[model samples]
Target: MDDTLREDQKLTVRAVLAREGRGFAEEIGLGRTNNPASLFGLLVTAVLVAPRGESSGPARAAHEVTNRWHTPADLAAASAQDVAKELGAAVEGVDRGDGDDSASDTAATLVALASAVSETWGGDLRGLREKAGHDPARERELLTALPGVDDGVVDVYFREVQPLWDEVAPFAGTRALRAAAALGLGESAEDLARYGNRPEKIGRLAGALARIDVEGSHDEVRRTAG
Candidate 1:
C-alpha cells in the first residue's frame, strides 16, 4: 500500500489510463448496458478465472454458455453435465491448469448456481439488483447467496455493472490489486479507479492490470490460492 507512483509519472499514468479505460469501456459498448443479463455474464465468467486473460479459458468456461444460457432459468433447465462440458473444453486447452476434476465441480456448481438464481432471484437478475438498492454491500450479500459466486465473483459482477450501481473502482481478484500496485497505481485498484472522473471505467482497467501479470509482464500471481 505504499504510494510508489512518482509525482511526475503519476499524473501522466492517471490521465492516460483513465482516458484509455473509458475508451475501452465504450469499445466494449457498455455505455447503455442491459441489467441482470450482463451482470449474470460477469458472474459466470468470474467462476472460471480472468475473462480477459490471453487464454480462451473464460470463453470455454462461461462465455460459451453466456450467449446460450441467457438467464438462470435457461441454465437451470439444461443438463448439468452439458454446462460442465463447456468448462471442460476451455480448461483442456489451457496450460498449468487446475488439478482437480473441475468438470464435476463445474457441473454441480453450475446446477446449483442456476438453481439458486432461479429460486432466489425468480430468474430475474434485476430482482437482486433491485434488492441491493444501490448499496454495494447489500449487492455483495445477495450475490454471495448464489452457489459459485464468492467474494471475488461478487466484486467482479458488481464492478462490471458499476456504471449502473455507481460504485467506484471495482476489482475481481487480488491479482488485479497487485497488478495496479506494480504499475504504481497503489495496492488498492479501487482507490486508483476513484482518481478517475468515471469510476466504473476502473472495472476494465482492473482487468487490464491483472492481465499484464498473467501474460508475464510482472511476477506471476498465484491465482488459485485461497
Candidate 2:
C-alpha cells in the first residue's frame, strides 16, 4: 500500500473522524479501552448492533444491558426472559422502529453471547486471545465460534477490538472498506491504514469508515473531503 495519502484522502479521514469517529463501544464510554470490562462491553455491543436495522436502538439497548451486567458472568447468570425485559424497555420507542419481536430476538442473542464468553473464556477475552495464539485469523475463527457471532458481527467486533488486540491492528472490514473506497481511501485494510499514518489511528480510522456506511454519511464525508 502507498505510504502517502492524497489531499482528498487526508481531508476525508480528518473530517469523518471529527464528525463520527467514535466506535459504538467508545460512544457508550468503552473508548477502545482494553480490559475485561471494556472487552465485554465491546463484544456485547457487537452482538446487539449486528442485527438491528438501525444502530441507535441497539446502542441504547447495549447501554441498558451492559450497565445491568458489568461482566459476562453476570449476564450469563440472568435468564433470557429477564434479559428480554430489559432490552425491550431500552429498545422501546427507539428510532429503529422495531417492535417486540426485534427486542426478543436481541435478548436471546445477548444471552447466548454472554453465556458463550462466560463459559469459554471465564468472562475474560484475554483467554480467547491466548487460545488463538494472538493470531488475527485464528482469533477471527475463534470469535466466529462464539454464539451469535457471524461474519457481520465479527466485523463490528474487529473494528473496535483492534485497538486492544495488537495482532489485529490495521484491520478494516467490508463496511469500512466500502466507506473508505467511497472517500478515495482505497478498499483494503492496508490501504486505509496508510491513510491513518500511525498505529493508534488505524482502529479509529477503521471505526470512522464503518460509521460512514452505517450512518449514510459517505456522500457528506466525500464533500467534506473535497
Candidate 3:
C-alpha cells in the first residue's frame, strides 16, 4: 500500500478497535485501568471459556489459576495432567469438550509462550511486553509461540491487550475482518491487514456488521466463510 493509503487504513482500524474495546470492556465489566497481563489472561480465558453457546466456566477457571500461579511460567511448570485436573475442577459444571485436550492445549500454550518470551527475548513476558511498543513483528512472533494459537488468536490478544501496554494499531482479527467488509473496506483478511490494524476502524466495521439484524446479511455470512 502507498504511504497515504496505509495511513488512512490505520486510522480506520483505530476507530474500529476503540469501539470494539469499549463493547468488550462493558461486556466483561472490566475497567480501562486493567493492565496488559491482566487482559491477556482474561482473553485467553475467554478463548477457553467462551465457545459458541457456552458459558464462561473456562474463563473463571483460568482466572483462578492465574491468580494462584501469578505467571504463565508458574502454570507451565505443572504436569499436563495436573493442569487439566485443576482446570476441570475450576470449570466444574461445564463440559470441556474432551477429557484432557482442552486443558493440555491451554497448558502447552502457556508454557510455550512463557518459554518463547524468555528464550527469544531474553526476558519474561513482563520484560518482552515492550516489544509490542517497539516491534510489531516481534510481538507477533512472541504471541505465535503459544500452541494452537493462530493469526486470529494472536490478533485478538494484541488488540485487546495493546492499550494496556500503551501501544497503538494492534492487529485486527476475524471480528475486524467482518467489520471492514460491512464498511465496504474489503472482503478478506488480507484486505483488512492491508488497510492497517487500527482498533477503531476495525471495531466500527465489526460493530456495524454485528448489528445487522437482517437475515442473510453478507457480514454475518462472512464470519462462517473462514
Q: Pick the candidate with the highest lDDT.
A: 2
lDDT of 3 by residue, 1-226 (tens): 3254544455544444443324333344444345434554645554453331123355456655555555455655656655555566456453444566656666565566545544664434445557566576776665666554555555555555555544535344555455566655566644654543455444334433333311224433334332
Runs in model 3 lying further than 4 Å from the true structure: 1-36, 39-43, 46-58, 89-99, 118-123, 129-133, 183-226
In candidate 3, where is summed lDDT lowest over 10 consecutive residues? Answer: 207-216
List the candidates ranked by TM-score, beginning with the highest: 2, 1, 3
lDDT (Cα, tens digit) per residue for candidate 2, span 1-226: 2446566667778898887776677676654577787888888888777666336567778878888888888888887767777776456343333345655666777888888888889889999999999998898899999888988888778877876786887788888888888777788988877765454577678777776787888878777767
Reference-based lDDT, each prediction: 0.59, 0.76, 0.49
| Candidate 1 colliding pairs | none
* C-alpha TM-score for every candidate: 0.72, 0.87, 0.54
Residue 51, candidate 2: Cα error in Å is: 2.6
Candidate 3 residue 156 Cα shift, in angstroms, is 0.6
* lDDT per residue as tens, model 1, 82-110: 66665555664433234445566676777
Q: For model 2, give the 10-residue run with minimal summed lDDT.
A: 90-99
User: Highest TM-score: which candidate?
Assistant: 2
